[model samples]
Target: MHLILTGATGLVGSGVLHAMLTTPTVSKISILSRRPVPMAEGHAKAHVIIHKDYTNYPSELMQQLRDADGCVWAQGISQNKVGKELKRNREYIEITHTYPLLFARALAASTAPKPVTFIYVSGEGATTSPGRFTPIFGVTKGRTETDLLALSKEAGSNLRAISLRPGGVDPTHHKEIAGFYPQRTGIEGIGGLILPVLRTVYSAMVSPTRDLGRVLTELAMGDGAPLSGRGVEGEGRTVTNVGMRRLAGL
Candidate 1:
């Protein structure tokens, strides 16, 4: 399958890139990033496209995306970054919400690929129902989710948009967190005791980055694999971390 990947430099995106590279079923990969992806080099099927802006894509780049079967949009900013900074909020919203929607629209318009799959990496805290009490981050992301779902429901549209609400994704170095359930003790030891306890607590809600990547890639592939039709209107489109872990066989 031909795939288009964004945010290859991020923690989860890097793992997704690794999974895609190793997966024999993937025939071609197109990476869109501001800077070239370091790991993409030397891979025959990998094409790294450098672009300063995601909002305005050149015709050539759009042409390449037109031929791809699916896209994995992992591009996003941290909640802190999106919330604390005013300038960054606007910039990030444009990048996170507007750009991906534009890309999906262009992909949907392309006729070369009959059907296109889009998997968006969203946070588990996102909620469509919001009020004065809701956090701004969740509200912003939830709005994006609503728009993407609306896009999926477009009349006779060939785009399948899936939002993945993965919880904390353990970094590569902390991958061991996913392996064991922690045992908390009341007796506090040395200064290092807090770290283990925190890891245990974190592991309960977090998933390994590798596993998240595998699930994202598998869902994007649209093989007779388990994740197909997951984004269809009636079916559950927003996948949580538990669902992601199950899909990744973790």
Candidate 2:
């Protein structure tokens, strides 16, 4: 199946990329990256499109997304900017608001079938209720979730949208971007003792990169066409690492 993915360079997105690549069912994986991403040779159908601006997407590729089988949208930055950082808040709003909405619109305007899905990566701390807090990370996430869900609901013709609210993706491979987040688990024995608990929880509540990718791959691979429709509104899903591996039979 042909798939499209964003944030190909971030920790979560990189893990998702690895998971999709290892899965045999995925034929082509297209990435919307700000810069060209480096991947190994013979990786399962990979395409890297260098597009710095996610807000202003190319019209031609918007049409091409119609033929895509699925999308794993892992874009957006993690933030904890508070107080004197109101500008940062504005930037967050711009990214979450314009980028996801525009991309979803582009995909919808493409061809029929709506490409089956467009999985959005969100945060676990987001509240189902509406309220804004200082350093409003959750507020941004909650708003994004609401907007995307609305977009999906209105998108007829078999379009589906799902949000993954992972607590913190423990990258077993990449280590550089770990410092980007305040809650990040970096190497050098910083968050060392936490790995075991993370490992166990990942096996249950969290969806590991490999497992989440497999689930998405399975859906994209046409494993269960009917089952893929169960989104947050339809069935509500929040994958932990443990649950991810178990579902993938790892």
Candidate 3:
């Protein structure tokens, strides 16, 4: 199947791209990005579309997207950059919602609105409840989730939608991105080391970034399950070294 995706440059997205390339059923992939992703030694049919602005992406590109079976939306800025970065959390939400909506609309307008599922990547603690305080991000993600669900309902049986919410991603990186903050550091790092212990003692749960990616890809290729309002649970999901070990076995 031909798949369209966003945010291939980011840490989480890059992992998603890696896993997707090996999926036997997924032959063609169109990654929406501002810049191209440099592929590893071998990957087949990974198309990078450099569309500068989703808001103003040409109709030709939209047509190209509609031709694809579905999309994996992994776009948006991080919450840590709220005060420091040029674009804040709210803008992040807008872009996230807008990009996916464009894909959904394009799919609906097509003559064959086949079983094209949209797998949206939200964040941990994205509230279903209104008026929660979560560093402005709660507001942004909450609204974005609401919008995606609404889009699915509006389409009725025409579109299938699913949401993934993963927390504290630890991308396998050699060097930290100069100024960017790592998700788990010092105390958080210490926490990761002893997390499996805590899990055994207190019955805790977490996930590895790779496992999260695997789980997401699994969800995208839905297993005869009907679409519901449920977002895939990844709460308290820390990508610790042990989780990494567990994933290696899989």
Candidate 4:
């Protein structure tokens, strides 16, 4: 199956890209990124699109995406960078909320076959409800989840939207990217110890990033049961960390 992947350079997305590259089931992978993605060298099936703007899509780009079977949206930013970063609020909202919604609409309008899957990478604590007390990250992500689910249920739409909420991702199996990992610090060092302890205890609060990637690839490839049996309409569902673990065979 051919698949379009956003944020292919990020931690979780990079893992997904790696897993898909080695999987025999997936024939082609189109990575949409601001810069050329590393580790895609010598892979004939890997197609890298160095897109500078996420806010807009040219007709030609849309045409390329329309031919794909599915998309995995792993683009997002941490809430901690709201004001400290340059216009990060807008950037976060654009990447996390607006871009996915727009892409979903375009894909839905496309002539691709029915039941096209769109997997969105959300967070563990995201809520469907937004309020004044809600953090900007949660508010934006929650709204995106809600809207995507609604879109899935729309008549004549062939999109099946699924949200994955993973927590405390363990990046041991991931390749080292220059700016992906945080600089070593006291708290970061402590997390190193804590992650191993949690894994030893089989804590469900954390998930291996590699496993998360595998689960997403399985879903995109339709490796399991049908998403729904309710007529010909598409479906929407959310998978938490535990569900992701089960899907990952962890």
Alpha-carbon RMSD of each model: 6.5, 4.8, 6.1, 4.3
TM-score of 1: 0.82
Evaluated with lDDT, which candidate comes out highest? 4
> In model 1, which residue pairs have backbone atoms overlapping below 3 Å?
none
Model 4 spans > 4 angstroms off? 84-89, 130-132, 174-193, 223-236
- Over the stretch 60-105, how does candidate 4's per-residue lDDT look in tens digits? 8878767777788887766554455634367778878999998888
For each candidate, give its TM-score against the true structure: 0.82, 0.75, 0.72, 0.84
Candidate 1 weakest ten by summed lDDT: 180-189
Q: lDDT of candidate 2 vs native? A: 0.61
Q: What are the clashing pairs of model 4?
A: none
RMSD of 1: 6.5
Better-scoring candidate (TM-score), 1 or 2:
1
Off by over 4 Å in 1: 82-89, 111-113, 173-199, 202-204, 223-235
Q: What is the C-alpha lDDT of each candidate?
A: 0.72, 0.61, 0.59, 0.75
Model 1: per-residue lDDT, tens digit, 1-250?
Answer: 8998988877667778887988999999999888877778789989998878777776777877777888899887654444456533586677667888887787788733488888888876777888878776677777787888788788887788888887766553634233222222233123124444545765444657778878889879872112433322214677776677667665
Give residue 173's lDDT in candidate 1 (0 to 100).
60
lDDT minimum window of 10 residues, candidate 2: 223-232
